[model samples]
Target: MPLIRVESLTKIYSSTKEGFAGIREVSFEVNEGEVVGVIGRSGCGKTTLLRCIAGFESSDSGKILLDGKSVSRPGPDRFMIFQGLDQLFPWLSLRGNLIFAMKTVNKDANMKELQRKAEYYLELVGLSEWGDCYPYQLSGGMKQRAFLARALSVNPRLLLLDEPFGSLDALGRKAMQDLLLRLWGKTGTTIILVTHDIDECIRLSDRILVFTKGTLKFNLINPLPRPRMSEDPAYMDFYGKISRILEKDANLKWANAVLR
Candidate 1:
């Protein structure tokens, strides 16, 4: 069975004046340990779809099943890491956040065990030296790295990333992407990443989903090899395909506006 099954899911904003503001009857399945990337223009419902799966939003129709069980509320089983550097608690140290998360998921864990696990994850993200530092003490990239570590410390069955490095610069984003890939090898956690950057999507995803006007228009497998490079023929092929999808949608939107 698939790890996640989103069947004919629909979530429309409450106001009709918004004119198709949310996803409509989207359906897809993500297998265990698979990394699926969601890409689309702004307001294409990529984030909306992710929010529903994370149980942060309720769908108006259809359902989302995790391991065949319907999801209706947020739980440690599904952990989300967002783009904001403020995701960490300002008052808590980096290690404190991870330790707190470990305790939340496994109440039986003692303080000593929590400390050990926290340190391990901090080291995993290369933030071991900054464990005692507060969120404000770290750079944007470092905070994001710490956020990833906190999410992994919980050992969630599904890791939801909503443009997790959107706030970082180009070099920082690339570094985080590499760190994510390295961490993926160690944890083997299933991931659903929503991103607007097509190149980033291709580098991290095994399959990609393209949305347009809140509809899942393209569900494709990435054909590029690992250690992916922009110069590869297959890389260009995959990029062109995704680019065409978005470009066509943009053209149609422009034509519609002209008619209006």
Candidate 2:
């Protein structure tokens, strides 16, 4: 059975006028240890779909099942790392935030165990010595690293990334991609990343799911070799294909708007 199964998921938002459709008739399954990337233009329901899976937003119809159980609300089983740098608590130091999650997840956890887990995750994210630093004292990339550490510290079964690298510069973004790939390889956590960067998606995911106009347009299985490089011929080809597909979808949207 799939680790995560989303069946005919649909979400609609209330409005004074016509209701806004977030996602309509979307369905997909993510297997254990599989990393799937969702790519699409802005306002194409990619984030909305992720939000539904993460339990931050409810679906009007359909079901989200994790480990054969339905997900009705947010829980630690599925940990989400958002795009915003302010995801970390401004009032607390990195150590405090990490400790809070560890304690919440394992109320019986002693300070020693919590400290060990926090240190391990901080080292994993290359932020070992910054535990005492507050969110306001860190750079954008450092803040993201802290968030990653906090999420992984809980040992979640699934990791949900919502444009987690959107705020990073090119170099920082590349570093983060590499870090995530290594972590995924080590922990074998099922990850579902929602991103607009075709190159990034192609590099990190074993399979790419394209969301167009609130529905899954296509799913591509990338057989490209590992330790992916943007200059590699096969990788470049896959990237170009996805880029074209996205562009085609955008053009169609533009045309429809003109007609309206």
Candidate 3:
């Protein structure tokens, strides 16, 4: 069975003269240990979909099922890492942040045990020596690594990422991508990531969900092999295909039929 199922989920921001904006009957499933990437232009409801799954937004219709249970509110089962470096607690150190995250979800967590786990995750993300540094003390990339480490500290069932690499430079973004894959390999955690970068999506996702104007238009499995690069033919082919889907969908005057 799928780890999470979104059934005909819809959330509208407004139906007034300003016009409607939100996901319309979007549905999909993420299997266990799968990394699913959501790619779309701005205002395409990809992030909205993620929020609904995270229970941050209430859907107007349909439902979200996680592990066969309906999700109605935010819980520890799902953890979201945002695009900003603000995710880390400014008042807390790297190890302190991780310990805080653990204590929130696991109230009975032993202090010594939690500290050990926090340091382990810090080392896992290459921040072992930076545990004493504050959020402001770290660079943009380092902050994101801390966010990843904190998220892993809890070992949540599902990881929700909203363009987590958006603030980094190109080189920094690529480095984070490599880090994400390495962490994903070690953790085998289920993840749903939202991003506007096609190359990033292709590099990290097992499957890609293409959204256009609040609608799910294409659900394509990554056809490229591992070690994907810009020069690879298969990678470019998959990228071009998704690009065309977005381009063609834009030219559509109205919603006709959504591609699977």
Candidate 4:
């Protein structure tokens, strides 16, 4: 069964600057343990769809189901990691933050077990040595890793990532992508990643959902094999196809606006 099912989800915002903003009739499903990537240009409601799924924003219409149950509000079963590194608590050390998150959901969990799990996830994210370090003391990439660890420590059934690596440098982004793959392999947690990077989406996602003008334009499965290398001809070919689709959609929107 699908772990997450978003049916005819719609949201609209009224504002003086950008009138009638938000997603419309968006729908998709995320299978258990599947990695789905949502991609589009800015102002395309990619993040809106993600926020709706995370329960951070209420949709004007439709439904979101998780594990066969309706999701009307935020819960421990779903955890979100945003693009900003400031999501971490500055006063708390990395390990402390993880422990605190664990306690929030599993209040009766034993301290020793929580600490053990914290350490395990820290090690998994390659931050074992920095567990005692404060968030302010770490680099941006390290801070993101800590955030990922903290989110995983809660044992969430679904992980929501919104351009989690967008702030990092090229090298840092690549490293985090590999780190994310390793962690996903270890945890088998279902993930919905919203990103503007097409190559990044192709590299990490099992399926890619293309959003344009507040609607789903395409839902496609990644046909490339594991350990996808951009240099490969097949990988480049697939990337070109996706890029063309995005470009075509953008042109169509521009033409429509001009006609109006």
Best by TM-score: 1
lDDT of 3: 0.91
Give a tens-digit lDDT track for model 4, residues 1-260.
79999999999885356344788888889999999999988888978887888899999999999988999889999999976648887899999999999999998999999999999999999899998999989988899899899999998999999999999999999999999999999899999998989989999999999988788989999999999999999999989988987887666766889999
Return the candidate ranking by TM-score, descending.
1, 3, 4, 2
Give the count of colliding residue pairs in each prediction: 0, 0, 0, 0
Candidate 2 ranges with C-alpha deviation above 4 Å: 14-20, 252-260
Looking at model 4, how many pairs of residues clash?
0
Per-candidate Cα RMSD to the true structure, in Å, reads 2.1, 2.6, 4.4, 2.8
lDDT (C-alpha) at residue 89 in model 3: 84
Query: How do the residues 189-256 of candidate 1 rate in per-residue lDDT, one tens digit apiece?
Result: 99999999999999999999999989999899988779999999989988999999998878576688
Which one wins on lDDT? 1
CA error at residue 101 for candidate 1, angstroms: 1.1
- Clashing residue pairs found in predicted model 2: none
lDDT against the true structure, each candidate: 0.92, 0.87, 0.91, 0.90
Backbone clash pairs for candidate 1 read: none
Q: Look at candidate 4 and tell me the lDDT of residue 242.
A: 88
Cα lDDT tens digits, model 3, 65-85, are: 999899979999999986563
